[model samples]
Target: MPYIPTRYFCLIAALVTLAIAVSARFATNDYFFFAGYVVLQYVVMATAWNILGGYTGYVNFGTAGFFAIGAYSAVVMHKLFEPPLVVSIAVGGVMSGLVGLGMGYLTLRLRGVFFAIATLALAIVLQTLITNWDFVGGSRGVYIIRPANGPFGHPYIQYLFLTMLVLSTIAVCIARAIEHSKLGYGLATIRDDELAAEAAGVPTLKLKLIATVLSGALMGMAGAPLPYYVTYLDPSSGFNLAFAVNSIAMPLIGGTSSWLGPVIGALLLATIQQIATVTISSALNLLIVGVIMVGFVVAAPNGIVGLFERGVRARRRPAKKEAA
Candidate 1:
């Protein structure tokens, strides 16, 4: 047998931890299960946003566009074909990816705030269109009447928790792959200097499009089951600013340089919000996130990961001096 690296061991340990957590949720009450599901969903969406916003330095304000597309996709599939839950999620992801690719192709030419504004405009337009569309429920909303018993039993929370868990895991894997691949380097170059990156033979437009498609697909997956979870879907709720803000804020606060950044930020922020909701108004959660985002931007622009790295280096300094 060959020796496994410490990193591989750590990875195995993390997977085990995740499995244990999922099992624990099954043994817990519905409220705990739902809370876990929401946090995991946030992790998925935030990680998806990080692909473009963090890696490519593109502030996409149209995450809600993909999210809405996904919810609608799921609703349409469930209403028309009566597909399985997994199929609905897949449909949402595919539809959102196609839309994202198109939007990327159109707006990748724009730079800085212009690109951001273009995405925001796209989101607004999509919201309006959905609001008028009645097939999947117009401005009123769509109600998803879940089955009493399915593959996962009568407990909706368990199924939602598992679904979100899988989605979040997939989101993390995709982010890690991009961060460690040539695409990641290209994105970093594009982020740092698009003109220089283009001069260096990086296909800026293609890379941006790929990133957008992937980001949108993952976001769509996160949103696909949302209608079932809430038992209702409305244009206003589906295309909310909180989705965009949380997706961006998590990466920024966690340290966008690595895949772990958005994951860490999402977990921390979601946990905080969940706890606060018990004692304070749920509406104040956004206020908390906004305050933290502003503070992080001014105090620790690199985020929690950056701070951790600095602390690690500081600890190692004394050991290096002793060895010398």
Candidate 2:
């Protein structure tokens, strides 16, 4: 594949977004917007998780913690001052980024399962704190009243969908930029072997920290719209394990090696899950995720992208052999 310029990519993305917006404008069902918003939210999140977990091989299980921090931060803003969604989103990203930095500093020294465990512990600790903090609704939860009409005068759900779509685009562009840059190479080295990377003066810790901060901030931004989307926030729902599970699963199921993987995975899985939620039952959502993920793990361990790449390579080999 030829290397495409970021500007060109952005232009293409803009066109695609405009097309989607036009389609949504004609959409008769508000459910379309609601479902699309969730899928796009996962796109942002899975991409964010891939930054640290896939790129840096950190495997953070504290996704829920960072996500809740963003939601709760938005809730606080709503209660105290009621800033615009954009401001709330920015604040949420900053808060989560700071937490990610702190968490990375404290736990980045540990490697492998130890690091993973530490992240799980971090989520648990944060959830416990949030449960006890009554100001943000504590164990009871809080309600957010969304405006009926959005800034553009469409229904608020459509606005949320558009917001998430833009965010997902930004996340993908960021991921692609990182993947093609020196930072990506540095993180890849750390992912492959942190000790070796450190010995070779790769600044493994710094790179990992950067990945963590980026990942957490993106996750937070993705979560910032949750209050408006759900209209209710609680410790239980805010810190749901499904967020962490799906974030990890989507990247793995799609292929962790590239930016496209998470997007593909999130779109496929979230869409399937949404369909299942409507047709079957919401209770079966996790079960569906587990079944599909297991099938992918067993059959295409490298993920759908990897499977496709392998097929392409196999087909190319015959042509090369014939040429020889």
Candidate 3:
């Protein structure tokens, strides 16, 4: 397929996503809205994680670290100045982006497994810090009373859904732009062979830092609305392992080679989790993810998108043979 312009694609996606979110106000089951909110939140999270993991080939296992940073940033801000959600989101993004920059500068030189291990360690460290910081309620957790219903006349859940929808659109747009740019080529080089990338005059550190900051900022943005969504927050909830695992799994399952992959992966996986949680025991959710991930790794290493592409290529090969 020929390339589609980022502007056009994102605009259409934004409109469509927003339209669906708006229509969700009419949902008879409030549970549906709640579930959609969770899914859209994952959409943003997965897309953000993909920027570093998929594009830069840096597998950051600290998704929860950045997510909690944003969550607590908003919480701190809310307690200090009672800012609106938009301001909270902006502050969270800036705070987390700065943290990402620092972390990248310190660890981006490491490659592969080493780098991944460092990130997981980072997440553990952050969790420990949050668990003790009584200013944000420490391990006791904090309660937040959501704001009044939005001016749109729908319930707050619908507004939250729309907020996430907009965020997801923006994240996807940015990812697509980066994927098609010269920066993307540099990242690919690093992903394939960092030493070769450096030998070719690529500024490996600069590019990796850029990826880290962007990914962390987006992940932070995704978490900014959490306070109002959950109403009660604790270190455990904010730093849940599910965020990290799901973020990684979504992109991998969707096909990490492109921006669209995470979007598709998040929707499918989140939807499955939502259904499975209701039908089966909630304790089995992680087990289900593990099983599916292992199956995909063994059977479709490249993910659903890759499998679809392979099928198309197979069909084309037969048609080309007929033509010959």
Candidate 4:
């Protein structure tokens, strides 16, 4: 069969997804909608995180900080003057993108673990600041009342799921576009060796800033909807380290090399975690992720994608020998 055009594939996928989201309301219960929303939210988070972490080789432990910035920004907006979800999400993205840009300006030059440490410090700082900001309830947290009438006629949770699905689609589109662009080549060079990339005129700092802003913005957008989903926002929950851990783990375990890796990783890891949470205990979810991450790192260092590529090449070698 002829290769399908990327745009056509993406368009068809989006339409199919829209169909599912609409049909899902009739077919599935609210619990599935709620759970699916969580999974899709991580799909956006993992994809966004990988733009910087996987592409540029800068591992950010501040995923929670950017995510909370989005959530808290929404809370502040709601209290001051409630806006629609889309508007609030945009505001959140801007807030987190600015933070990322500032952080990149100061610390992007610090290579490797040092840069990661800086991001960790930033997360801690943001968490502390939010904990003291009483307007948004600070450590006490704030409660959000979802609008009785959602954008469409559907229940609010279902609407939230659809919104996440759209956001996840948008994020994946951006990542795939970037992966196939010259920018991706620059990022790969930087990831492999910043010195060589810089020597080759890759505009290292500028590229890093772009990756940081895009990654943080997408992360913020993902977190923006959480206020409606959770109904309560606290620094403790908003700044939970699980965001950082899972975002990092999902991308790593899926394969950090391409756009689809994070999505695959998120779906697999999230589905398994969801199952474990139901049959096992919710507390064991993170432990399972940890064990799986360690195993992937040791056994398949390049992730599921790497293993897949290896398998394909292994099969190809036998075919080549037969042809010869």
- Name the top TM-score candidate: 2
Model 4, span 117-137: residue lDDT tens: 999999999999999999999
lDDT per residue as tens, model 3, 287-322:
877888999999999988888899999999989999
Error of 3 at 279 (Å): 2.2
lDDT of each: 0.87, 0.93, 0.89, 0.91
Q: What is the lDDT of residue 246 in candidate 2?
A: 94
Candidate 1, poorest ten consecutive residues by summed lDDT:
1-10
Question: Which order, best to worst by lDDT?
Answer: 2, 4, 3, 1
Model 1 residue 301 CA deviation (Å) reads 0.7
TM-scores, one per candidate: 0.93, 0.98, 0.97, 0.97
Best by lDDT: 2
Local error of candidate 4 at 16, Å?
3.6
lDDT of 2 at 233: 95
Best of the two (3, 4) by lDDT: 4
- The backbone clash count of each candidate, in order, is 0, 0, 0, 0
| Model 4 misplacement above 4 A | 1-6
Q: Please say which candidate is ahead in lDDT: 1 or 2.
A: 2
Clashing pairs in 1: none
lDDT at 282, model 4? 80
* lDDT by residue (tens digit), candidate 1, 143-190: 998765557564766777777877887788778877777999999999
lDDT of each residue in 175-258, candidate 2, tens digit only? 988998899999999989877888888998889889999999999999899999999999999999999999999999999999
Worst 10 residues of 3 by lDDT: 147-156
